[model samples]
Target: MKVIKEISLLREALRDKRKDGSTVGFVPTMGFLHEGHQSLLKRAREENDIVVLSVFVNPIQFGPNEDFETYPRDIERDEQAAYEAGVDFIFYPSVEEMYPHKAGVSLIVNSRTNVLCGAKRPGHFDGVVTVLTKLFNIIQPDQAYFGLKDAQQVAVIDSLIRDFNIPVELVPVNTVREEDGLAKSSRNVFLSEEERQQAPAIFKSLQKARALIDSGERNPEKVIAGIKEELDSSTSGEIDYAELLSYPELERVEEIQGKIIIALAVKFSRARLIDNIIVEI
Candidate 1:
């Protein structure tokens, strides 16, 4: 596959593709390619005439104490995986290339940023929206793919697209998981042998919560309690947050109705893992 590092070069390449009446599908990712990322790229490849995958570790999306500097990177491996997944182009831009000067204004995020991972990591989604805005503009694809593993992130991007009238279609792909049910993540490498064995409890608890909701449980507190009980009994990891909230908007709901998300984040010894299940009630 062709790799373009400069912004202008990538834009020119895309312009040429558009002139040929090819539809572009974009998959934005930080490197350390895995099956989960490839799943998005494969789907994008199937849907669009030209598929573009970006491998930039967006520094702005990371917090001060976060693992920005230490976040994983393997461009050579990522390129091979992208090529196998049928990617047409790889946009591997540097931080300087992405942000040459200090931003004069920021994307005003909606109230959805006040809960879940957002509540724990302040300004995280702001960085996410800002970087995504830049990527969307650069690629100008007909469709963009994101995994449901970051359901809240998908929700925020959905809101951003609707509010800002971004032309690209936001395609939400289902979360890819291991045989044991733990959501696949780059941070999984940090999990100790013991921690890896226990990590599946996160997804197990989410499944329990989904079962409880499907079995006529309408109270949000009760559903959350069921999930927490499972996590407490099964895993040694510390619970970050186990919540049941409105889907997409993430607002607190008194009763479980319409659509809702049962989300959780657990801090193991080394890795912080997150998982969720979206249910229509």
Candidate 2:
């Protein structure tokens, strides 16, 4: 597995690959290896000739009071996982290398960013789209892969490609979960033992919400209430946001119809976890 840290070197490598007709599949991530990230790498490996994994903790995407400085990082372990997953290249760039001069321009996908995680963490998606655009340009991949855990993020990237006419194909991989149904995330590391035990309630609540919707319960209020109630019982869990909204669009829907997304975020002692389930009704 070759590791490239400089932008020019990475771009030159990509140009050479294109000349050789090698299809590049890129997985851009904020380091901290987990099974969910591995799933993305595996899928990228299967579909493309060369799989490039980037491990840069984007400082722009993190807001003040957020865990940007303290976010997990283990390049040694992540490289092992990526290499075993058949990744071809690892682009490990420094913050200065990524944003040499203050990023004068930003790629803003507005309407899509005004809800969910966006509403809570302002400018979150902007930072995401901005860095992703930079990575796409630098790597010049034929396709890019992202996990479906961040359903809202998937929507934003979808709009970004459509609106900008970027040639790269955007692939959405399914969310990987724990044996007990909790969505696997790097942030899961932040959960203390007690918090980890209570973490499953988030997924359990989603299951309850899905059941309510599947059983002909259409009222959004009722579904939301039931989910809230489940989390309310958790002595260690703190509810962040629980809503049943249209998948991708993220607008609140009164009656569950086609595909609706049940997304939730809860804070444990040290970590904030987000998960979602889609139901067709």
Candidate 3:
């Protein structure tokens, strides 16, 4: 696999692949790659002729108090993982290269940006949309792969594609998790030993929520309370926000009828984590 840190060099690499009749598949990620990221790459390789995985820990997506500087990164290790995952090029661009001029304007998908993760971390998805728009513009991939672990982020990106008419296929891959059921994330490293043990409760709580919905529990308050109750009883983790919302569109729902997304964000002693389950009721 080729690693190109310079934006021009990366574009040149992509151009070569495009000229050779290769369909580009892009996986945008902050570094600290794990099996979850690898799964996205593997899927990309299966469908596309060339896979470009970007490893820029976008500063904009992080809040002022968030862990922008401490976000884990090791380009060498990331490049190796990318190579093993069948990536053709690693687009590792610097902040300066990404934003040479001031960001005079930004892309935002409204309504979709005000719940769950967005409610807790204001302006988070705006940064996500902006950086993702930049990456999509640069890579111009035939298909872009994103993990379903971040369901809200997936929704926001899809909205951007529709609202802006960006001509690239957006693919949502399944959420990858640890053996113990905790969702794999770069921030998982922040968990202390006890927090790591309690972290899986987030997933367990979501699973229970799904079970309740599957059992014909449609009242949003009941479903949400059950989830919160699980977290309250079994863990010391702080509840950030828990809600059941309409799938894809993400509008908050009082009663789930057809398809709805049950999502939650919880903070352990260390870092905040988010998870969701989409179900048909």
Best by lDDT: 1
For each candidate, what is the lDDT?
A: 0.92, 0.89, 0.88
lDDT of 2: 0.89
Residue-pair clashes per prediction, in order, are: 0, 0, 0
Per-model TM-score versus the true fold: 0.98, 0.97, 0.97
Off by over 4 Å in 3: none
Best by TM-score: 1
lDDT per residue (tens digit) for residues 1-281 in model 1: 79999999999989988997899999999989888998999899999999999999998888999999989899999989988898999999999999999999998676788888999998889999999999999999999999999999999999999999999999999999999999999999999998899899999988888888889999999989998899899888999998889998899999999999989999988779999999997
User: What is the TM-score (0 to 1) of candidate 1?
Assistant: 0.98
Whole-structure CA lDDT of model 1: 0.92
Pairs of residues clashing in candidate 3: none
Report the C-alpha lDDT of model 3 over 121-161, residue by residue, as the tens digit. 78888888898888988889999999999999899898899
lDDT of 2 at 33: 79
